[model samples]
Target: MYAYQCIYLADVYLCEAGKLLVVPMDGSHWFTMRSVVEKLIERGHELVVVMPEVSWQLGQSLNCTVKSYKTSYTLEDIDRAMKDFAGTHWTVRDDNMVSLWMGSGYNFFELVFSHCRSLFNDKKLVEYLKESSFDAVFVEPFDMCGLIVAKYLSLPSVVFTRAVFCHYLREATQCPNPLSYVPLNFVSSSDVMTFKERVWNHITHFQERLFCHHFFKSVLDFASEVFPEPVTLYDLFSHTSIWLIRTDFVFDYPKPVMPNMVYVGGINCHGGKPLSKATKPGSRTQHGYDPLT
Candidate 1:
């Protein structure tokens, strides 16, 4: 086994060289997963990326084999959703917050699912994957379609989420999530929570879990109709080889993580040239800071 180390990216262990099929959710997600794909390619692993046509620039820059699919929703739909959410009058009240969250969730889901549906219907994409003898599949965990494709191809799958924490992936991996101390994503709470805050966290966590469960269930049912195999979404997720979460203690609060759940946070951070002594504060050169003595 070979282990590579870096200051920003997580330490990855590779036992052998093989081709990896990368499936990114959308343009934004393609940008997030770009570094990972690039690292794999640098390690002499072949890569095949499947992404939305909106990310054609990214695919072209990667200089790898790519299969781009068209989506029904346009960039305008995304802009509208952002405008609606940002334009809303936000408040601390439960009703107002809940309304905003749910509305945004629905709009985002519609946009994502529309793309997923289009990817499923692309016979050429499906045929390409069927013919490509990929060793494993690397999927962004935004949609279940990638998991379904992995199942259809009988390949081991790994999930890489750009978020600090993904509740669905955590739950699927049976990781310990003590809601009492672990705050929900966007809940604006520290590791230690007050009694009332813990209660609120529990309620919000439960609500999100319930909503996502049903949402994925519907997606799974629709996928089942199109794919020849009859596997539930839960099965596909539960069997995932690893869940790569983008997080690090440098910025994130402490939390429990399972063995399979690896934190690759700060993987995007890159180093630059050091500050020259001439440019340093209290130096004599131009742009240098002057002492107040």
Candidate 2:
């Protein structure tokens, strides 16, 4: 019976053994993607992570192949940009808010696109991708670089996000995004928006669209050199198999979602280890919780 069970497990493992090409945005985005990678590895799938040199150490620790590429920006650059723009008092009404959003978006796009361009220039990486046979590409579609790369390799792609809502992804999927009721991610409003808030949301959504269009136009122009003829980011994204969003209705406002969009909120919370003795209920001391005890 034990031998039979072992054979059964081996067959299951063999059945589940498929290669995945994971393309994640740099910096804290890796932390968000880490759980997904772990889940894939647990399910017996091989992962090929294409990341910046700074995250090579992290990739080395994972049970998968790591492809490191040199990039002009580092995690520190992202951190600095966030710190410069992020503050408590900023609001949609503030003039500086627009500047903040624009500046931050530009920095993020520059970093992501620059890294992607570096990967495109890497002959060895390109050759390896061409040779590799992946079941699917798992990507954080911050820009369409992941989709472009997946197109180059002729693999199906799955786009995932840690954000509550992504306007670009919504547009790509042609998902319903009613600005009247649905607040923009940057806009601090609820599902039941006031008249003024609804108007503000519309304006913000328009701005976002314009910003993305300009940036994506430039990205696609650069991508034409790397991707084959008759390729567009919209086409690539529309054909994606699924979008695993890290949000749930409980924590987020009600909104219409497409069939391909899967709400995987609290995926990281599930199957997590229980709290230790010190943090567990009734384990706290008068002085404080003693983890060593």
Clashes by residue pair, model 1: 247-265
RMSD to true structure for each model, in Å: 5.5, 6.1
Q: Write the per-residue lDDT of candidate 2 for residues 161-264, one digit (tens) a residue.
A: 76622366777778888889887776788899899999999888778666656656657777777756755667667767788887676787888888888888
For model 2, name the residue pairs that clash. Answer: none
TM-score of each model, in listed order? 0.78, 0.76
Off by over 4 Å in 2: 1-14, 56-60, 73-97, 164-166, 228-233, 270-293
Best by TM-score: 1
In model 1, what lDDT does residue 119 have?
Answer: 78
True-vs-predicted CA distance for residue 96, candidate 2, Å:
6.5
Model 2's TM-score against the true structure: 0.76
Give candidate 2's error at residue 147 in angstroms: 1.8
